[model samples]
Target: MLKRRPLAVLLGLALLSGCATLGEGGASRLDLIRQRRSLRCGVSGKIPGFSYLQTDGSYSGLDVDLCKAFAAAFVPETGAVDYRPLTAPERFTALRTGEIDLLSRNTTMNLSRDAAGGNGLSFAPVVFHDGQGLMVTTDSGINRLEDLQGQSICVGSGTTTEQNLNDAFEARGIAYTPIKYQDLNQVVAGYLQGRCQAMTSDRSQLAAARSGFADPRRHRILEEVLSKEPLAPASVGGDQRLADAMRWVVYALITAEELGITQATVQRRYNEAKRRPELTRLRRFFGIDAGLGEKLGLNDDFVVKVIRATGHYGEIYNRNLGPQSQVPIPRGLNRLGRDGGVMVAPPFQ
Candidate 1:
């Protein structure tokens, strides 16, 4: 007493179900980027060495270079990036709402952000290893964290820096007053006006702020690091393909440095690799026959474009935050792992 449907109807129903699944899955962000022919990257343009808006109305800095590298990899034209400058409080929301395709600001990765604060976002590999620190006029004679026991500190509101400052001070049982401001500019103004005895933020940011002071020599960033800050780019979660592509783009930069590849040598080496069968790994990396880039839904020569645009990791750092730049923070923990730092790229193969 059972009835069977026609084969045609059954096939049609199965096809409809498959179509629903495909629609629910949606197009990956990568596909969207290719279709749109551009990548929207979020950045905090206030910081000098990380992401700064120049007087010429152009953006430059470490984070900016990363975004450019990403754009070169994702877009048809090399270095085609739409940079959206966001504040500390606005960065995450902008990313979650798809106002920006990627966030390449100096954002720290932590448990709360990776889980709760991100609202279903995932961070890429760590690009910069930083720590919270304080800065004060040398005249203040605040050589260490304890010296600011009773002093008021100028901090930016709605940032991890403010929270870390409080936690560090409380942990040492040191009493201090916090003068919170709405933005980095306000915090800097408060410190300059002597409303607070010291300014606190990530060490790199402190150095950048000090460099802009009328008399940069007057201030000094203390050596005391309050908390670990692993700065990285971020993207919306739930798309493993997009996440892997973003992560590998960062990894390619680091790997290029490890492999003794630089922008200056990239072209020469690429040409040389073709003649040498011994350069199989290099050939594979350049997509001679290996389909690594295709597997990731990208062109095989994506890494070449990335390097040509942004250079290697060390080169990017040198161009933005190294000794030649306005903020010359030493690459202590940011050096490659083989060189005694934590920056190790996974094997490309």
Candidate 2:
């Protein structure tokens, strides 16, 4: 006969298993967000085209719109939000400590940042597809990454930007000095102040920073991309409920774009869905039939709320980083898969 464990030992094991289950399915963060009546969102307040504080004491940018979208989805019509401007180093800590419910900064999703044994953050779908690039003064005669082999590069500290810089330069056997700052604003300042010959960041960010300069034409982003940076929103890991809700929220943005559901056309599409019961996908997407949003622990009409608050992903992008915006980045890989870009979303069904 197989030997049985001691009574106390078996009880202890059972208790431990129960505790683990509780930790996994504990008091839902989604419920807390609903009860709190607002979302505490973290963002890099200094990045111009991503998230910036305006003269009118308002926040505007793609990331800012994302926060509003989340608030709209979670809090319904009012879209109440508390914007917490966080530095590169402070973003993760704030999320983990419950200081913020969502981090919509231009943060890259990497293995270390998403892994359970690492930063333990659950990331939403990528909202921005960017690449690391080196920005140098147009008159510097630097046309490529190798040109800065012996020069100092200004970079934001404690970010994937810095790591990608080192990796790219090292792989190419290009040695350089790095002047690090606590955040992107400081890094841009250091570059403008002549503390470094070049500044490295997401190419789109470089364009954003350049546009703010007195002479924007003086800076040029190198064509050689250093690395792929798929930026997304993040929340503290282990909250599957919150993660599920956030993931689907982002997917809603993409799905809206894929379905040609513009802000002005959302209600039209909803009406069509209502009148035509055969439009199965549109019916479920707009919450006319429910299920999708409820599966993520959100109101069935959250997608409709999000779109009304922030528009679809393309609209948000064009409004922030398109030609008319201060920071204009060609929607290279950010376009929909059908539009020859890589972005796509799962079916609402």
Candidate 3:
């Protein structure tokens, strides 16, 4: 004979299953971003000019600008954003657990991340192009990476730069000790405090950290760049809509720069472009309706807000990290395609 469950027990089981389903199908990442009222962005806690926290408890850097740009796109009038400073190890998990809407940290995009090597996530566009390098004290008598044999090197954990350092040294049969830290600040502190003889990270990061030092002239960044670091934003996997929207945001920035559209000119020229079909279409590229923003459950003006708030790609880059910034990193390979760099945007139309 079959034993029937009590009515209360049966009801409880039914309710539990329903709750499970509801939780599983609750909302998409896009919906969450909208409902949250502000985009939660993960960034480096302290990387100096790249992604450090400001005195006002806000963030300002190339990576920070990108996050703010996306948030402004989502909410134009408010331009609201929640910047979460995450260490290298915390960034990936935060994105995966939906603790953050995006990872705008100074993270390098590589095959492992792109391939989703069991982490169940991937990168967006290559927002900033960077390469790994080593920095040491000017008086260390070491001018090259090859000179660091049997020396101690400081690097961050859960970062590509550390692995690159190990691989480069091993390939050349050089011996060294890796003093791993969580982010650039600790790596810098370690080197500055003589805990390590050399500090290794992305070249732009090295420059940024050096610029923030008490005595910038005391340290020198080596000339040997080891690896190609396509620094970009990241989002968790299984959300095609969110991923596409984020990807296109980056593309739009590049496109705006390539199309010679600055924030100052976007509005003035947008009205004039209304008379020209090509210009109108180009203006629409920034999610100006036509179903792009709608597809992502965002207002049509989302991208326009991003461009207006942060300017086009070149404007943002130059303003935050280029000649105008304190660090003054040269836009070497970051130039537009016409200038022999890899930056190019697809036709907005």
Over 4 Å off in model 2, which ranges?
1-25, 134-200, 217-224
Per-residue alpha-carbon lDDT of model 2 for 1-349, expressed as tens digits? 2355577789999768744633654676778889999989999889888999999989999999999999999989468999999999998878866788889999989999999878888999999988988888989999888899899999996658888999999999999999888998999889999999999888877888788899876777776778898999998777888888888888999999888898898888888899999998789898889677778778888988899888899999999988778887768788899998889998888
**What ranking emerges by TM-score with the best candidate at the front?**
1, 2, 3
TM-score of each: 0.78, 0.77, 0.73
lDDT: worst 10-residue window of model 1:
18-27
**Candidate 1, position 254, lDDT:** 96
Stretches of model 3 off by over 4 angstroms after superposition: 1-23, 134-201, 214-224, 278-280, 286-289
lDDT by residue (tens digit), candidate 1, 303-325: 88988888999999999888667
Clashes of each: 0, 0, 0
After superposition on all CA atoms, what RMSD does each candidate show versus the true structure?
A: 8.5, 6.9, 6.5
Q: Candidate 3 lDDT, tens digit per residue, 1-349?
A: 2455577789999768744533455357877777778888898858765787779987788888888888887666677888888888988868765688889887877667767455556578888788888888889999877789899999997646777888889989999999988977888888999989898887887888778789877777776668887888988766777787788788878887877878898786666665666655765775543657776666776666777888888888887777547676657667788987888877655
- Which candidate wins on lDDT? 2
- Among these predictions, the greatest TM-score belongs to 1
| Model 2 global lDDT (CA atoms, 0 to 1) | 0.87
- Weakest 10 consecutive residues of candidate 2 by summed lDDT: 17-26
Arrange candidates by lDDT, highest first: which order? 2, 1, 3
